[model samples]
Target: MLALSAVHETLGKILEPPTLHTAVIFTPAGQLVSWQSNPLCAKDDVHLVIGLSGDAWQGAREKGYGMVHHNHLGKILVVPVEDVERKPGEDKPPLMLLALNATDEMEWADMQVKGKALGAALTKSWSKHREHLTVPKPPQSSVAILTGSKRVTTR
Candidate 1:
C-alpha cells in the first residue's frame, strides 16, 4: 500500500500541468489496495479487473506498451473529458483518467523523452519499495535461445 502511495505521489509530481485525475493500485485478486484522486464514476466502472478483462489492455501489452513504468504490469486507459458527458448535479469538474496497470511491464520508452527519465526513476524506486511484488520470470529456455541472436520473439 505504501508503495502505491509513493507511486501516486511521485507520478502526480512528475506529470504536471494536465494533472492526473486518479491513480489506483489493485491487487491480483482485484482488491483496490490504494488510490489517489477523485473517482467521479461508480467503483465498478473504474475497477481494475474490468480494465484487465477488456481488449484494450491486452492490445497494449501485445504491442509492448503496457504500464507507464516497466516494472509493474498493467494497462493505462486515458479517458478524455470530451468523450464523456457530465451527469446532472455533479458539481465536480471532469478530468482525464490516467489508469496505470501496475501489473504490466513498465513501457517507459513509449513515453515522451522528457517524461521517460522520470518514469524510469519512479519505476526503480517503486520496485524497491514493493520488493515483495512478484514479477513473472522469463522462461529459461527463451533466454538460452536468444543468447547468440538479436532476433526478438513474437508471441
Candidate 2:
C-alpha cells in the first residue's frame, strides 16, 4: 500500500510551492486511504468527509482527472483550501500545503490542466508496478451470460 507520507512527499516534489498543500487518496467506497495536509485539517475528520464525498470523486472522473495509481477506480480532487483562523487572539491554524492565494486563480487553472498530465504519469508508473496493486475488472455478468449452467443459485 502507498503510504500517506510518500504521497505527500511525491506531490510536494511535483507541484509548485503555491499549489503544494495537500493530497488525499480515497477508496471507491469513500473511505480515506491516505492524506497529507495541514495538521489542523489532517486531524479533522471533516476534511476527510469532503475528500471522500461521492460528488467530488464522480465529478473528477467525469472531467477525466485523477491519479491512475493502478487500473482501479480512484480520483484526485484539487480544490481551493479554506483558510481558517483560530478564535480571537489565538494562533492561526497550520496552512494547507497546496493552498493557493485567491489571486492565483489562473495558476490554479493551469495546475488543473497539468494535473491531467500528472495522471498519465501516474498511470504509467502504476502499470510498471502492476503486481503490487489489484486492478478491478468489470462484472462477469455484464460481459457474458452463463447459458449452459446446470443450476441457478439465488441468495
Candidate 2's residue-wise lDDT over 101-147, tens digit each? 11232344565665445444444444444344433555665553346
Q: Across residues 38-148, which tens digit of lDDT does each residue of candidate 1 receive?
A: 333356644743355233434453332233332233334422111133355553321212344322333334333323344345444444433354434567666523546
For candidate 2, report its TM-score: 0.45
Candidate 2 Cα errors over 4 Å, as ranges: 1-6, 15-20, 38-40, 45-53, 66-108, 128-132, 135-155
**TM-score for each candidate, following the candidate numbering:** 0.38, 0.45
In candidate 1, how many Å is residue 51 off? 2.1
- Model 2 / residue 21 / CA error / Å: 1.6
